[model samples]
Target: MTPETSETTQAPEGHAPSHRADGRRFRWNKVPEITVYFWVIKVLCTTVGETAADLLNEKLGMGLTGVSLLMSALLVAVLVAQFRTRAYRPGVYWLAVALISVVGTLISDNLTDNLGVPLETSTIVFAIGLAVVFAAWYRTERTLSIHHVDTRRRETFYWLAVLFTFALGTAAGDLVAERLDLGYWISAGLFALAIAAVAVAHFALGLNAVWTFWIAYILTRPLGASMGDYLSQPTADGGLGLGTVVTSVLFLAVILGLVIFLAVTRRDVIEQDRITPQVAR
Candidate 1:
């Protein structure tokens, strides 16, 4: 990721500075604040993404291609609703996240299972893709801060980056867990440790917030995916044997309850800058 410019100093973790270096506050951001709730929900979405994709592929009998197309279509529809709204709507935003998670997993799966791409190759490919998106986004917008995701263009860049993160995470996680024979539990532990280190670097070592945030975001996908596999796979396969159906439903239910709570409480809402009408124009 590009270095955050001096003009874009770090705000508190999970909060963005309201005023830019130019003294202009952006319009209301469309994403929720990076609160604990946000991280919990994001991990849950990724877990559901991993297992739910498996469930659909098994039950739908439509093959990976069919499931990918179906999930991708649903993702597009939810994103359309997300874009139509003027501000953050927890339901719409998270629904899009969950759908994108599934779609992202499917993309990685298709490349590996169908096209015979090696996990290492896919991992590198997706990492490059994510970097390109970030570079393009930073070049065009001059900042890659999530707090500034108020405009439609920024939101577009944000989602594209998110999709790549999930895809990259899936590929990398599989490379470590399956290819390297690390096992699901071990893989999950490793990713969790990695995320913890990123946090320490940001809080204790004074790393750039923008870089740490994106790094943690990308790592959560594999962590969550590994967790999902550990819980849902067969006992003989080193899992708890809950099965994908149970695992997916459990995570989805939790996600639904949280989304409803956030919608009602509005705790995660990022308030718009108190700009007057003339200034807003």
Candidate 2:
């Protein structure tokens, strides 16, 4: 067999036997399984969330509070639907992520803009909150692996961590951009470099998966938000002046196309059988 055919033939042997029978696996759902495609679409969704929130608040004149409230309600509804489902559905999962991303950005914005909270304070607060969440999750379950998120408690922790990451990222990004005087493009570049570093540490340096995952997850928020700001803000604000509406629409289209492709191909299905703890007997 050709090398390609040999690799293809080996793929089936890697899956757990249980997956072959029932197709229900103990893997991440409500989100795309981690792949390059997953990260690309995640960044796109975050960009949409950032720009869409801005459009709703600025162009539509909804104001920050109004847009925040609207998106918060939508996020809660989608999350409820997500929790209700037993299996991962791409449509439901991505919608939840997108909505939560918007709400998360709004939470940070509200603190900084409306409540007069310092970005530093917000960043520290979110970091503490995220640490508490991980502590509680690990203490209760004795594991933080995403592959084992088959129970309600684990899933709740998963979403909570996600929310905190966005909030934390928003604060950190703004801190670097506004307080530290890094321009939008520079901020984006810094965050991109940080994410690359995390990937290197994870794959090359024997870093813990959980730590690597959360670090990269938090970084993506700022990376995406900075890119969104670069594309949508006025020239005076250092952006290209595409406007939030156009930026949001463009990213949303890409997200929709990708989600549809994943749904149809099932390329991200988690293989539950591989998750079984090996016995040393």
Best by TM-score: 1
lDDT scores of the candidates, listed in order: 0.87, 0.81
Off by over 4 Å in 2: 1-31, 277-281
Q: How accurate is candidate 2 locally (lDDT)?
A: 0.81
Clashing pairs in 2: none
Model 1 ranges off by over 4 Å = 1-26, 274-281
Model 2 per-residue lDDT at 88:
70
**For every candidate, C-alpha RMSD to the true structure in Å:** 6.3, 7.9
Per residue, candidate 2 scores C-alpha lDDT tens digits across 1-281 of 22211121112333433433333323333344688878998898788878987888887678899888888999999989998775677899889989988999999999999999999999999999999999998877777777766556678999999999999988988888887778888989999999999999989998998899889989999999999999999999788999988899999999999899988887876655545521111
Q: Which 10 consecutive residues of model 1 have the lowest summed lDDT? A: 272-281
